[model samples]
Structure formats: C-alpha cells, structure tokens
Target: MPKISPKLAICIVYVAAMMMDGLDATIVGPALLAIGGALGVSPAATNMVEVSFLVSFALVIPAAGWLADRFGTRRVFLGALAVFTLASGLCGAATTAGGLVAARVLQGLAGGMLAPVGMAMLFRSFPPEERLGVSRFLMLPTTLAPALGPILGGFLTDHLSWRWVFWINLPLGLATVLFGLLALPEHVEEDAGRFDLRGFALATPGLGLLMFALGEGAARGWGDPLVLGAGLLGACLLALLIPAELRSPAPMLDLRLLADAPFRSAALVAVLASGGLLGMLYVFPLMYQDALGATALDAGLTVFPESLGLMLATAAIGWSFPRLGARRVMALGLLGAAAAFVLMSRVAPGTSPWAVRALLLAVGFFLGHAVLAVQTVVFDTIADEAMGRASSLLSVLRQIGGAAGVAASAAVLAASGGAGLGAYQAALLASVAFLGGALLFALQIRPAPAPQLRAEAEPSV
Candidate 1:
C-alpha cells in the first residue's frame, strides 16, 4: 500500500477533530432535560452545562494563537484534543450538575484552543491558491456536524441515554488525537514574542463577559441587571483592548492583519453572513417546534436537507470559483441566500414542511458559496508566520457574530410578543436584512486571481 501523504493525513486529523468539536458543542441541547433530571436539578439549571462551555471557550480563544506560536502547532493541537477527549469522558461519567459543569468548562477551554490552532495548521499545510481544496474538506465538518447534532442527540437520548451524547466523542476524538500525533507536522514561530499579559488580561474577561451577556440576555431579557452589567463592562473592556493591543509590540490578536483589504473585506462579510446563517438556524428549530407544533426529531429532520445542499454546493465550488471569481461568486451567493430568507419569511402556520425544507436547502446552497468564497480568499495574502494570529482573530469575530445573531433573533421574537408563526417570520426577515448587509460588503471584495497549481514535496509523517 502507498504511504499516506502527510497533507492527507493532516486533513483527516483536522476534519475528524473539528467534526467532534462541532458535534460536542451542539449535541447537548436535546439532552439538557434528561441531564437535569438525572442530576436532580431543574432543567433551567442544566443550562450552565452549555454556558460554562461557551464562556470558557470564548475566554480561551484570544490566547490560542500565542499558545500555538509558543508551543508549536502540532503540540498545541494534539494536547487540546487529548484534553477535550478526556473532558468528554468526564462529562459522560458525571453524576452531579456541578461535576458536569466543571467538566464542560474544561471541555470548552480545550475546544477553544483546538479549533483555531487546527485551522492554522490546515491552512499552513496548503498554499493559498489551493485553499479551495481546503474549503471542500472544511464543508463536511462545518455543515454536517451542526446539522446532525440535534437529530443525533434526540435519537440517542430516546433510544440509549443522554450519557451517550458525550460518550460518543470518545472513539472519534481518541482516534483523531492518535493520528494527529503520528502525522501532523510541527510549526513554531521563532519570534513568537513574550506572552501578551496585558492583552490576555483584557480580552479574556472582555470576551467571556460579552458572551455571557449575549447568551443570557436572550433568555433573561436585556434589562436584567446581570446581563446589563456584564454587557456594559464587557463592552468597556473590549473598547480599551483595541488601543492597548494596537500599541503593543507583540499583540495577542495582531489586529493589524485587518489592514489588508482582502482580509478585511472577507472577514467582515464572513461575520455578517455567519450572523444571518446562525440566526436562521437558531430560530428555525424554535419555529418548527413551537409555531408549527412539530416534534423535536421531526423539526431536526426538516432542517437536515440544508446540510445536503451545503455538501452539494461545496462540491460544485471548484467549478464555480474559477468561472465567477470570488467577487461575483460571493455577491451572487449572498443575493441568492437573501432570496431564500425572503421566501422563508412568508412561511405561516399552514405552510407545507416540504416548502420550508426546499427554502432551507436553497439557503444552505447559496450561503455555502459565500462562505467558501470567504474561506478561500480571507487569508490569501497572510504570511505563513502570521497565520495563527489571523485565524485567532477571525475565530473571535465569528464567535461574537454567532452569539449576537442568536440574541438578535430572540430580541425580535420578544418584540413581536411571542413565538408564534408571525413572530418567527419577523425574526427570519431580520436574518435576511443581515444577508443584505453582507452582500454590500461582498461587493467590496476584490476579485481573487486565478489559482495556479504547483507540485511541492510532501513532508513524510
């Protein structure tokens, strides 16, 4: 048998790790009630299981680049994967709410580091011109994992046990970690610089608090003192962080990367598009379950076709990217996504589920084009040394965008007075507006040059 290429091995490791990470993040939602009952706590209290993970995840992300630069990408990625797998086991074994929450925090810390560092490694493995290939690999984990999460969780909870949700990661995570240790290449920047204590001091609490506020504000209402206080303080700290990091000789985030036009345009478009897409995802399930009175499993199934559309679009991107260029592809993609949302906004109580499924599939297909375009072009000009920092910054922005999107959807639902079909429609239209805003930014992106293929020596594992 031919020895596996180092790049292929890395891709396999990265995809498996990311799929597990994404799956873990979303899979617990359907099990929350079961977990609460098993642990002798109210379902509301079990929310901390997710909150702990998200908060710790947000807190750790700003430091991921520094860790990767200081400790080499391969070491950091493998270490994080190991810790995540262990935490998954702990989560599965927990008998108390506190134990589960503690384990989740550990899981979040590991996951926060895992994703961006892994992304930096993957991008470094491939040249800029060949990133469309990377994007194709990317679509599987990013699209399928989240789409399948709720369905899998519901099934496992009903047929086996909620513990299986966390336990399921064990084999996948362990296999990926072992493969990664054997195959992943080491990369460390010599001038990684001293730890940015000041930036970390500011960013950790700032992002953590902001994430908490955004998450809780939707459930507890924006006027709640805790939410208001956290939001205000978090905003203030982040405001201060900008100037401090900008002046530091070695910034943690390397905000200066945004100065590149392609990077800036693509990042902005990505954040806006992420907000719309995630918002739609969050709202649609609620709409199906509440407004249409569908079962949880049925609701998840209805949305599953979107993942199929995403997969199909990702497969077609190589053909489209060469012909349309990044600018036209992204612009037309966003426009098409917005049209899908417009149709969704017309959905009512009596609307056919098939129609909703078709609209969602359309949304995923068009949005996939825009998303892959961003991924392909965002780092086209970033140097190899700065890849870690650039990936960290983009990750931070996408996190904020996703949280803010969910919060905005919740706010619109509240304003419309309830979770009725009309309220859900209004919230979806808000997503369309976000897509419209993204289209404007997509238009500003300069067309990427045609890719030139070149053969380079592959490093042996």
Candidate 2:
C-alpha cells in the first residue's frame, strides 16, 4: 500500500467527517413524516426534531473555535465525530418525539464542531494558493452529500425504516472517527487565551434564538407570537453582542476579522451566494412536487444535475484559479449564476423537467466557480493562529445566510399565496436578486499578485 502523506490523511479525515455532517443535516427531511408517525407525534410537533437540531447547532458554532484552540483540533474533531455517531445511535433508538429531539440536539452540538475545525485543519494543511487543489475534497462533502440526502432518505424511508436514516451514519461516523484518530494531527494555539465567556454568553443565546425564530417563522407564520418574540429578543441580543465582542480581549467570534478587505469581501460573497443557492435548493423541491406534481424521487433526481455540474466545475477550478485569478473567476461565476436564476424564474408548471435540469446544471456550475473562489481566498491573509476563530465566524455567517435565504424564499412564496407557479417563480427570482448582490461584492475582490499566482502554479519540489 502507498503511504498516505499527512496532508492527504487530513483531507481524507476532514472530508469523511464533513460528508457525514452534511448527510445528517438533510437526511432527516424525507423521513420526518415516518418519524412523526412512529413516535405518535402530530405533524406540527414533528418539526421540533429539525428545529431542535438547528437551534442547538447554532448555539454550539460560536464555541467551536475556542474549544479547538484550547484543547486541540484533532481531539475536538474526533471527540465531536464520536459524539455525533453516538447521538445518531440514540436518535435511531428513540421511542418518543422528545427523546428523538434530545438526541438530535446532541447530534447538532457535535455536528456544529465538525465543519469549522475540520475546515481549519484542511486549509492549514495547504498553502493559500495551493488550497485550490483540495477543491475535490470539498465537492463531495459540501455539494454531493446535501444533494444526495433527500434521495437517500426517501429510499431508506420507503424500503426499510425511518430509523435507518440515522442508523446509516453509524458506520460512516465510526469509520471516520477511527481513521481520524490514527491520521489527524493535533495543534493548539498558545495565544488562544481564556474562554471568551462574555462573548459566548451574549452570542450563543442570541444566535440560538435567531435561528429558532427563522426556522419557526418559515414553518409557522411570522405573525406567531413565539416567532415575533424570539426574533425580537434575538435581534436585540445580537445588536449588543457586536460592540461587546469588539471590546473583549478574547472574543468568541472575533468580529474584527471583517477589517481585512479580502476576508470581508469573501465572507459577504459567501453569505449571499450560499443563501441564494441554498434557498434555491429549498424552493426547487417544493416547486417540483407541489406546483408541477412530480414525485419526491423525481424532484430529487431533477436536482441531482446541480451536484453533477458542481463536481465538474470544482474539478476545473484547480486549473482555473491560477490562470484567471480569484476576482475575475468570481465575477464571471456570479454573472453566469445570476443569468441561470433569471432563466429558472421563467420556469412554469408546463415546463419540461429536462429544461429545468439543464438550468440547474448551469446554476451549480457557476456557483461552484464562485463558492470555491471565496473559500480559496477567505483565509489567504489570516494567520494560522487565528484560522480557528476565522473559520468559526465564517461558518456562523454562512449558517445565518442559509437560514435567511430559506426565510426570505418562504416569505416570498407566502406572499404569492404559496401554491402556484407564479409564487415559486417569484421565490426563485428572490434568489437571483441575492446573486446580483453577490456579484457586486465579487467585483470588489482584489486578486492575488502575479508573483503569488506564478508560485502557486509551479510544481512543488
């Protein structure tokens, strides 16, 4: 057997952990009805399973960086992976809705740590310019897993049991944990400082409540008192959190990173672009199944082309980034993605599935270009010592963006009366508007210097 380099081993471990995380996040969707049925819960009550995960996931994200820095990346990541696997077992074995929700909370807490810490490890393993080479590792975990989730979930629910959805994570998660233990290197930042209790106290509940409000508002009406109360309270806390974090000697989120132009631009572009893409994912299935009367399987299959396009585009990015520079690539990508959304906005109930598939392919291809560029450039200037906090902050922002996207899309659909081709079309156009905003930011990105690009292109000694 060929010896695995440390970098290759790190990539494998990160990809495995993230793939499981992504799969777990979306896999529960298709099994919700079955899960609710088995647990003897009302459909409305069943939503708690997902909401619990989202809130807990939001709550733990701000703490991930500190834990990784204070302890060690390998330890935190492997521990999280092990806990996530154990939680998956608990979820599968649950006899009641409350039990299931509790297990999911554990799952979310652990799941939240996997991404940022693993991301930090992955990026730290490669130089800034050479980071593009790891794009393939990213594609499976980020794009393919989410795209495959509904399909896999639906299949498991139909053929076997809803419990299988969570159970499936067991082998995958356990294998990852074992491999990670053997292969992953440990790193701790000496300057990580004491825990940012003040920042954590303020940011944690604030983000949790905000995520709760966003998730509930999309499901329940925005006018619901719970939604209103949570949203207002969350917003107020977060408002106070900003200044508090800035003044703190060791902030949990490190908002000061935004002062760096490349990081700021990349972060903003990530939020907008991911919001649009995720919003489209949320809306497209509903449009297909409800408005167009397609089956769940058909909807999932139609959406699969997007992942295919993303994989192809990501494979090409390793070649493209050194030649075009990040700025031009991002701009062109945003432009193309916006155009694809514009085309998709015109999709009607009468439209052919193949036509929709082709458009989604374009959307995914363009988004691959934009997202990979953002990822490659985000940490270019960030010191290794700060990579943990930077990754945490970016993860939090992207999560918020994703929730906002789903909420905004839901709001648009609700405004248009929720059950027509026109409503879905309007919702999609909302995503296009987001892509346009991302384009504006993408244009602002300053490309790396020519010398750096040349260095990135040359073969390593």
Candidate 3:
C-alpha cells in the first residue's frame, strides 16, 4: 500500500481552511436580506453586520505576524478555527443585527490568522517545483466556496432560515480542527523580539480610517464631512506607517524587503490590478437586483458559473505555472480577464444573461493568480524569519485593494448621473481597462531560476 505524505495531509487541512474562508466571505451576501427581515432591521444595518467582518479581517491582518510569532502558525490556526466555529454558531442564535455583527467580528479575528499563516507554511515548506501543485490543490476550496455559498446560503435562507448560515460553520470547523490535530505538522518558532507598539498603532488607524471612510461613503455619501475627515486621517496614517516601519526595531511589515524588485513590483501591481476584479463583484449583484429586477435565486444562479470558471483557472495555472514561467502565465490570465470585463461593459436592457454568465466565467478563470502568484513572488524574495510579516502585508494589501476598487468604481458611476445602462456599461469598461493595465505590470515580474528556487521556502513562520 502507498503511504500518504505529510505534505498531502497538510494540503487537506489547507483546503478545508481556505474553503471556509471563501465561504465566510460570500455566505453573508445571500443571507443579508433574510437576516434583515429576521432581525427586523433595515437593509443597511444588516449590511454593516457583513461589513463588520471585512473591517475586522482587514484590521487584524497586520497583527497576524505578531500573534503568529508569539504562538506559532499551527497553534494559532487551530485556535482560530475553534474560535471561528464557536462564534459562527453563536451568530446563528442571535436575534438582533448587533448581536450578529459582534459575533462576526469574533469570527473575523479568528479567520485573519488562517490564510496568511497557511500561505506562510506552504511557502516555507514546499519545494519550488511543487508550489503550483500546492496552489492548485488549495485553490479548489476557494473556488467552490463562492459558487457554493450563494446556492447553499440562498437555499438555506429560503428554505431553512438565515441563521443556518452561521450554523453551517460549526460542523465544518470542527472537522477541520479535529482532522488537523492529527495531520498538521508543528514548527517551533522563536520568542518575540521587541514589540512594535508604534507600528501596530500606525497600521491599525491607517487601514481603519481608510476603510471607515469608504464604508461610510457607501451609505452616507462621500461629500459628508465625516468621510472627508476620515480619508484625510487615513492617508496621513499610512504616510506615517511607511517611515515608521523603516525605523522600527520590530517593524510589522519589513519595508526593507522592498529592495527586491520582483516582490515589490508584484505587491504594488496587486494593489492596482485587484481593484476592478472585486469592484465588479460588488457592483454586479446590485445591478441585477436594483436595476435589472432579478430575483435573488436568479442572480446567484447566473453568477455561479463565473465562480466555477475562476476555480478551474486556478487549478489549470497551478498545474501549468512551473512550465510556463510565472510572468507569461499571469499576464495571459490578466489579459483574458480584461477581455471579460470589456464584454461586460456592453450589457444593456434585455441583454442575454447567458452572455453575462459567459463573461463572468472568463473573468474568474484568469483571476486565480491574484493570490497564488503574488504570494509565490513574495515568498521567493523573503527569508523564513520574515515570513509571518510578509504574508500579513500581502493579505492586508489585497483587502485594501478590493475595498478601494469597489468604492472608486461606484463613485465614478454615481457622479455620472446614474444614466441608465450607460452608467453600468461605462463602469465595466473602466474595470477592463484597469485589468489590462495590471496585465502590463504583471509582465515585469521575474520568476526564480529553477536552480535558485528554495527547497523549503517559508518553513518556520
């Protein structure tokens, strides 16, 4: 009989954890309306309950390094899964929007550790030739979650109750934790050096101020004084955080690593390119429901194929990356996505939903590398000691990019007088343009020579 490898076992835990991560992000979207009705709150209140999770997830990412260093990746991840499971179940019990929002915050805190830590482990342990295999395998759960979340969450919300959305996490989390206990390997980590209290203070308010501004702008209008003040404060905080990291004894993000051109370029490109990808997602469902007059089930059904396309793309690229070279592979993906967005821009009243689904499927197919290759480049440049910090920075950047993308696109469309299908069409066109630019930038990343690829990339975390 053949023996199961340790890497394979770890991959199992990775898949379970990532599937839940994507599931958590999308599960709320389908249930948000049901939750509003159940709690007798306005749609906006219920939406905040969802935003509360994103905020917590973004805010905690920078600190994941500190926590992981003090506790070790394996221990922190298991603890996080337990916390997420317990909190999700409690969310199922809540009768009020506030209660659900509070519970989601707990889940977010727990979840913040899982993705970055897992990425660190894979980066540290896998041989370079094996990364695409690991990335492809891990990508499956993420791909399935969104496509599944709406279908499943929508079904449960419609047939069961919205609370079941939270209830669903309990069994999944428990199984992952239990299975991981026996399968996930342990890596010993050193004691924390000096704590970067200043760095934490900087990043916390830096990201928090920006997110608060964007979220408030979403509901209250960007012209409001509060939003303007918050934006100003956020920009200043970030300006301070960059210099502070350069000077700190224990910088949270390790700005020095920016010396590596490939890693630095990839990170910046991610910040730029990811905007339209997530923004369109934020825009599309609203377009369907508010303007196009589609039912919840119809909207989800139309979108599921897109998620499937993305999952399939991730798997294909992971299998092909070693042979194609990361630069050529990623550029082709972005270029394909750019074409998809251009197709979406042509939508008008009575435009075929079949065509729309085809466009979305194409978009998802190429977006697999936003995380997959970005992290691969980052891990290639940094050493083991910096793995935790590097992963945290990458995760935080991705969140910021998504939020910024959605808000910026919406702002443009709104300012253009909300002019029927023209506005929607224009916004989609802009998104395509953005992705095309990302493709240009992606072509610049240099893959590691086969001889230079690390045997154990990000081992200790």
Candidate 4:
C-alpha cells in the first residue's frame, strides 16, 4: 500500500471530526419523536434535548482556541474526542429525559472543541497558498453528513433502537483517537499566555445566553421575558467582550482578525451561508411532513438527493476554483443559491414533491460551490500563528448564524399562523432575502493574493 501523506492524514482527521459534529446535529432530529415516546415526555419538553446541546456547544466554542493555544492542538483534539465518546455512551444509556439532556450537554461541550481545533490543525499543517487541497477533505462532511443524518437516523430508529444513534459514535470516536495519536502533529504557540479570565467571563455566558434566547425565541414567544432579557443581556455582554479582548494583552477570540479585508468578507460569507443552509434544514423537514404530509422516513429520503447534488458541485469546484478564479465561482454560487430559494418560495401546497426535491437539489449544488470557494480562499490570508483563533471565530460565527437562521425562519413561520403551505413559503422567502444579502457579500470577496511561504517545522508521520 502507498504511504499516506502526513498532510492528507491530518486533513482526513479534520474531516472525521467535522463529520461527527454534523452527524450528531442532524441524526437527533429524526430520533426526537422516538426519544419523547420512550421517555414518556411531551414533545415540547423533549425538544430541550436539542436545545441543551446547542446552548452547551455555543458556550464552549470560544474557549476552544484558547485551550488549543494553552496546550497543543493534538492534546486538545484527543481530549475532545474522549469527552465526546464518553458522553455518547452516557447519552445512549440515559433512562430519563433530564438524564439524556445532561448527557447531550456534555456531548455538545466536547463537540464544541472538535471542529475548530481540527481546523486549526489542518490549516497549520498546510501552507496558506496550498490550502485549496483542504477542500477535498472538507466537502464530504460538509455536504453529506447532515444530508445523510436524517436518513441514517430514520433507518436506525425504524430498524433498531434510537439509542443506536449514540452508540454508533463509539467505534468512530475510538478509531479517530487511535489514528490521531499516530498521525496528528502537535502545534503549540510560542508565547502560550495566561487564561483570559475576564474575557472568558464576558464572552462565554454572553454567547450562551444569546444562543439560548435565539434558539428558544420562536418555540416560546419572542416577547417572553426570558427571551427578551436574555437577548438584551447577551447583547450587552458581547458588546462589552469586544473592547475587553482588544484591550487585553492576550485575547481568546482575537477580534482584531476582522480588521483584515479578506477575512472580514469571508466571515460575512460564512455567516450568511450558514444562516441560509441552516434555515433550509429547518424548513425542508416541515415542508415535506407538515405541508406535504409525508412520513418522517419519506421526508428524509426526499431530501437525500441534495447530497448527490452537493457532491457533484464540490467535485467540480476542485477543477473550477483554480481555473475560473474563486471570486467568480463564488458569485455564481450565491446567485444559484438565491435562485433555488426563489424557486422554493414559490412552491405551492399542491406542487409536485419531485419539483420541490429538484429545487432543493439545486440549492445543495449551488450552496456547495459557494461554501467550498470561500473556505478555500479564506485561509490564503491567514498566517499560521493566528489560524487557531481565526478558526474558532469562524466556527462561532457559523453557529450563531445557524441559530439565528433557525430563530428567524421559525418566527416567519409563526407569523404566518399556518394555513400549512403558506407558512413554509413565507419562511423560505425570508431565506431568499438572507441569500440575496449573502450574494452582496460574495461580490465583495476579492481574490486573496498568494501568500509567501516560510520554512519552519514540517511534520513527518
């Protein structure tokens, strides 16, 4: 057998970590009903399983960069894997809804660190100019994991136990640890500074509160005091976190990165893309089930073609990015995504399911192109030293964007007071508006000039 390149191995590790995050996020959706039934909880109360995970995940993300810097990427990654694996086991064994929610919170805390830490490792392993190769690894998890999550969840729930979903993570997590121990390189910062306690105090709870408010806003009323107060308090804390970090000698998040033109534009693209994609993820299941009256399994299968479209576009981007320039390709992707949303917005109650599926498939293709293009180009502007914090910031923004998308889309649905199809359409139109704004940001993403590579430490596996 041919030897695997060290860089390739690292990229594979990163993709695997991302896949875990994606799979967990999507897989639980299908199992919610089963879990509620098994636990003898009301559907409203059971939704807290997902909510707990999201809140805990958001709380830990800002700390990921700091931990990776304080320790080493390898150590942090391994630790995260351990936490996630053990928590998955606990989640599978839970007997009560509260117990399950607690286990999931632990799982989310661990999962929170995986993606950003893995990203810091990958970006540091590859030079900026050469980072386009990272896309080959990223595309699969980004495109397929969520798309496959519901299908796999449905299959497991129907054929086996819902507990199998959590059980499934065990072997994968163990293998990841073994491979990582052998192959993943340790990257430590030169001046590993003190823990930013004040910054952490502000940012952590701030983001957590904000995510909770946004996440729960639609489910509960936005006007609810919990939602209103948390939103206000979180916003204030986050606003204060900015100057606190900028003034601190060693910042956790490095908010200064946003000052860079390329990074800022790319960050905007990340936020917008996440918002739109997550919004669709929220809406499509409703469209299939509530609007069209399909079964859970059928709804999941209907969305499966989207993965095919994403894979096709991602494969094509590897060829097209270098030839056509990232900017043009990304612009085209934004427009394509906007078009897909436009089509989806016009979908009537009686519209053929196949027609709706085709539009979703198209959204996957176009959005895939947009996601790959921006992720590839963004790293070209980041230096090795700052990659950790930048990766964490991007991850945080993506999560926030997703949470906001779910909230905003849900609000729109609630406002329509549902004659079924009309609510979904209005929600989709809101997504289209988000895409249009994202396109404007895409237009501003100028091509980053190739970076000047320097000789330093190179990894040998």
Give per-model TM-scores: 0.78, 0.79, 0.77, 0.79
Query: What TM-score number comes out for model 4?
Result: 0.79
lDDT of 4 by residue, 1-461 (tens): 35677787787777777777778888776665568678976333344566567667766887887789889999999889889989999999999986997899899899998877887787788898777656554665654676688888767876898898898888988888888888777888987668778888998778777866765565576899999999899999999999998998877778899999888887788788877776776676666666666656666676676766776775677666666676777788888988888787777667887887788788778888787777776666889998867877777776667666666676677667633777878887877777777788888877644422222211000
* CA-RMSD of model 3: 5.4
Q: After superposition, how far is residue 361 of candidate 2 from its true place, in Å?
A: 1.3
Instruction: Report the Cα lDDT for residue 103, model 3.
Output: 90
lDDT of 2 by residue, 1-461 (tens): 34668898888888788778878766765566567668975333454576567557766887787788889999999999999999999999999876898898899889988877887787778988778767644654565676688788767876788899999999988888888777778899887768878887887778777766766665577899999999899999999999999998878788999999889988899989877886677677667666677755666667777777787776777778778889988899989988988888787778888999998888878888888878877788899999877977887787667656666776677667765788888888888888888888988888775312222221100
lDDT of each: 0.77, 0.77, 0.69, 0.75
Separate clash counts for every candidate: 0, 0, 5, 0
Off by over 4 Å in 2: 1-16, 25-59, 68-75, 89-105, 116-147, 161-163, 174-192, 318-325, 380-388, 446-461
lDDT, candidate 1, 308-406, per-residue tens: 677767677778877888888889989998999888878777889898889878887899888887777778889999886887788777666665665
Q: Quick one: how many clashes does candidate 3 have? A: 5
Worst 10 residues of 2 by lDDT: 452-461
**How accurate locally is residue 415 in candidate 4, as Cα lDDT from 0 to 100?**
65
